[model samples]
Target chain A: MTKPVLHLQPRVKTMISNATLEQASYEIMKKAAIDIPEDYLAGIKSVAAKESEQLSGFVIKTMINNYEAATEDRRPMCADTGLPRYYVKVGDHARFDGGFTGMERAMRSATARATIDVPLRPNRVHPLWRTDNNNNVGINSPEVEWSFEPDADWIDITTVHKGGLFGTDYRMLFPGDGIDGIKRFLLDTLISFGKRGLCCQPAIIGIGLGGSKDTCMQLGKQAACLRVVGNRNPDPKIAELEVELKDVANGIGMGPMGFVGSSMAVDLHIEVGHTHTGGMPISVHTFCLSSRRATARIHADDTIEYRTDPMWFTPYYRRETVIWENT
Target chain B: MLNKVNLDLPASPDDIAKLAIGSIVFLNGIVYTAREGVYNKVLVDGRELPDDLTSRSNVNFHCSPAASKNENGEFHIGGVTATASFRFSKYLAQWLDLTNTKIVIGKGGMPVNDYKNILAPRGAVYLTTVGYGTGALLGRGVQSVDAVHWLNELGIAQALWIFKVKNFGPFLVDSDLQGNSLFAQQGELINQNVEGLYDGLKEPALHRYGETGNRKDELM
Candidate 1:
């Protein structure tokens, strides 16, 4: 049997100019600073529906009002506009007019510009001298991380305004300890620090399992920034664990702002990878209810599309009812 | 029941003591903003209090707001960032004693014992506003912003701003001068809940993950 003859379409080289990249970066940063993503807003609304506690409901309502006011006025949602972080996915086939360094330079300039235009709070302080750079431009001012995608013709950039609130914690568990150990570690951390303004309730919890410490941490951060609320891991066991952890966290009743409420964490996102047989590293990164993130794409033609959802994680179907165990 | 009281600056000990945990206040008059650096400079570094901030009924906001200048070069405040209060609780206890500050406003509740020992004796209350509701707090609550100090030195994070506010809260009185803390009580209840959940899960956790001989240590 002869293989069918296949005709390959000619590849079109996309020319992404530094100016276009800079402008796109600026637009994304501005939008991220001012706007909370639609999915997050929807999650807030959903949780608001379930909030029976008077103060929690009032806080949630106020959050919705604040979101509206911030968007309308083009003001930042939170005063802590936070440290700017950019995650860039470069297509293997895409070519930059000025190369990668040029792209980095463009991102830096765009960040500086947005710092002034969006008037983002200058949260970056000199690490050693403790001096303030009014423009928020210093060594590695806007942290940029890159990844390459094969056979892709467009670049996707997601900007995150990492606030000062959410604190990250990591632990190395013995492989023999198993998944139950991971659960215990997570619960212990959340119970102790979650209410201490670290893991803000009604938060988006991201858990990274089974990697080196750095890899786990990076994956956890990505999970927190890019995962959509109400979405879970694609793996069945991990997805079930996500639901169970969500139930357990919310059951703590730390509530909104750590007051009293039924709604604590709105969603849990877990990313797992194989690790050395001896070590199972776990890292937890939380995004507060305000979860500030935005994404933009630059096509081969240089046409830009701004997106509310970054669309990083796999989506899972929601369970209609969560079974509660009698304690 | 939550009370809607309008508190004036240099609030008297009686006023601070009268407030109860869970009471809502609509603060009027002037409040000064302060964060870590300001606390360090004043309390730790032994800097003198500026005349502008010397009111006996002082309300210090634990905020580092995002403020910007308009085309006219007039500064307009964006809103306040709610930081963790416990980070500054010990310093605040000292500052309150030194300054006789009446009210402290921030996000998250401070240590329970601090409210009982330091704050109650000094005649102060800790109020909590909705976290991340900066725009709502600025647009609807704060009346005006003025006297931005340390804008160039500390950046917006530590720059002290004098905010004139009217009905500026729906602030929950998390800590009152009567040695009561709403959040502290909530924390205790949460602790109980966590303990209960952990206790229930212990047997299952041990059964699933525990070694045959050393079950208890792994659970711990």
Candidate 2:
């Protein structure tokens, strides 16, 4: 859980190398694919403990075994391997040997290398042509999104391998529609994709409220992939709604693989942004059974620390208000 | 405890009859991978399949293994999981008729209509992979990559792969001889309480075009 400092002296001589970044990137890719995060593992265990349906319970127990098998075998938990993508956070004071573009090249090559070494299913392709590059790298295939952190001197990179289909949607609602509208949309997305376990239930459901449509989609996806189970929004009301939504999702009378049970959600996360007063655009994203994600923080000294928890939504990243709105 | 059975590949009519919805299944023998890519090639393009294909194996897997060729030209398969079966429903009937495929394995089960109308009469059954994330376990069951086809054209994800497998399951029987489907039965039970989840949620002020009250086309 690294936090941003208010002010810090910038260091001069130490710079992280591009090779180190690539190595870390490739390592996290493997880790994300094979090892289910500790928090999510605990969350699923709790969900399994309370799952009452006989068959659904069997599925959960099988999943527990699957996770162990994945680690011991050192193989990916799921063959889909998903749409591998990245979130790169650059510390303002950080210095690296290669420029940003060079880092990008390193990341891209790392993606290609990991795809073959780990043999990740090359899931990406041309939108219409369907041409497979076979390396999981093509024209903007493994999307790399960048952000910056203030008063920090380390670059943090998180890779998320999320499924491309199902358990996601976007809708435009009027402010007049209110929270009830949100509830309806959530139920609609869940029930629709939760059929035959298409969305792969007991998933971590993420909701994005406010912002424009595109931002809403990004926020919701980030809320789903970037946050760990049981982590809540900073806003108290949003946090409470998170709890309520999880209960609602779990009470849907469905469990893993869409079987009849009460374990539909591992947890629910909500992210919001100020938007046009006239409309509330919303997006829902469900990070499924194999919620694969991993993070690495590269210090100025080039020492890297890898972990499952992303710690992506730092307080500074979610700060509200502007001291000066106009010049 | 759910009933579990080990099925032999190139199964006979009697073997398919023993399957029932909700039972777990494992397979021993040969299975071949074929989805839209292989389907369009053989069924649509009117191409000929291997002469002894049906005689060799009757199980058509809607799968694409995470596999790669090592420097030695041998394949290293990491994980194996099925793609959604419902999407390939259009090809199954023809595929089954052409190749005598008796067992279909994939991620989600095929449509309920598919079971009753297409599969039952042909003595075919559907088995859905459990968790849909049991790739590693399934990978362990793969004895060897016996052969592969269309690797260059369809690519690995859509290539036709022939695998020798043992203890290859943990798949739930989604459809049986009588056309009864485990998913459909469970779905019906789930739908009974589905409305309760939206008991008090009101409609939004704005509704998108083509937004139906129900997803009638949803697979069972």
Best by lDDT: 2
Interface Cα RMSD in Å, per prediction? 3.3, 0.9
Q: Write the per-residue lDDT of candidate 1 for residues A1-327, one digit (tens) a residue.
A: 999999999976468888899999999988987888988888878888988887777767767887887898787787777788788888778877898889888888887888777778777878888887766678876788887665678888888887754557787777666766777777766766667444555778888887788889988888778888877776788889988888877777777777678777778888876788888888887787668898889998888999978765422111212542210
Model 1 error, position B201 (Å): 4.7
Write one digit per residue (lDDT tens) for candidate 2, span A20-83: 9999999999999999999999999999999989989999888888889899999999898999
For candidate 2, chain B by itself scores a TM value of 0.94
The lDDT per prediction is 0.75, 0.89
Candidate 1 regions off by >4 Å?
A1-14, A313-327, B1-3, B6-15, B70-72, B132-136, B200-220
TM-score of the first chain alone, every candidate: 0.88, 0.94
Question: Can you give the lDDT of residue A266 in candidate 1?
Answer: 73
DockQ, candidate no. 2: 0.77
